[model samples]
Target: MSTRQYGTFVVIGSGSGIGNHVAYTFAVKGFSHIIPLARNDWTYNRVCFFNAARIVLGGLLESVETIEENFETTNIALYIVAQWAIPRLRALSASSAAAKSSLLVTNSLLYANPIPQLFSLSLVKAAQCSLVMSLAKTFNSSGIHIALVTVGGAVAPEKLESKKYC
Candidate 1:
């Protein structure tokens, strides 16, 4: 059966892992417009500047996440990605007639349930939660629903795959 009755969903960070889970969930539910924010070893490092930033900063920041290991692609370039991608997705959804259109984020319960090892993830997830809430408040009246789901823990297999441009 479908998780959503009907709608359009665009998932980011769906190369592999949690982000992929969210994308597959929506696809099974029969939602159109699935977009995967993919990355790999080569592009993930060379294209992604987070590590470079860390190096430039001399590793002083302990919270700097590795591109391959981190699901928070929204973190490395939040301002640019969110600004351009999110707006475009919103616009596309606005043009569609799908019911219950929304954005879903895969966060960890590790943050929610409470544990020091996962505190950083929790913080990132908390920020995602806040963003969802803010988006909900801003768009609910306009007919968009936003949900921040905590996946409880990391799971095997991803819902989507990353496409590399050769």
Candidate 2:
């Protein structure tokens, strides 16, 4: 016999890739209340590197400032979502004795072992992990499960392509 997971799921960063996959997977597994939160797309040109490593490497240090700004934007968005969703999550859990609400944060394994060029991402993921851990303890007795799922390695191109259908 298999155990079924019940209640509402609030998935952050459900815009693409792992986030998209996770949200779809939860729905396929019989989760009726699925909240997928996605961030607005941030666009930038690749003019800094036009088939030349030297030019890109030259601007590496400056990218950190840009990365930090992006991280702040994303962090604030996530905070807003969490603040708005918590009350609903509580209501859903309290309405049913068996219901269990969970907040699932999608993170990268680079959080633990920071990558050189992806330092900004690593910092954000690490902070998210910390937030999840703190929330887990804070809400332990409230029947709300907070979890951070870290994904590592290269995602197959097929999976990336399949995200469109998901």
lDDT (C-alpha, whole model) for all candidates: 0.48, 0.57
In candidate 2, which residue pairs clash?
Answer: none
Q: Which of the numbered candidates is closest to the native, going by highest TM-score?
A: 2
Model 2: lDDT of residue 59:
30
Residue ranges of candidate 2 with Cα displaced over 4 Å: 1-60, 160-166
Task: Please state the error at residue 71 of candidate 2 in Å.
Answer: 1.7
Candidate 2 lDDT over residue span 14-83, tens digit each: 6667775786667556565667665544111000100100111213255666666645654555566567
Candidate 1: where is the Cα deviation over 4 Å? 1-80, 93-100, 158-166
| Residue 139 of model 1, lDDT score | 60
Clashes of each: 2, 0
Q: How accurate is candidate 2 locally (lDDT)?
A: 0.57
lDDT of 1 at 140: 57
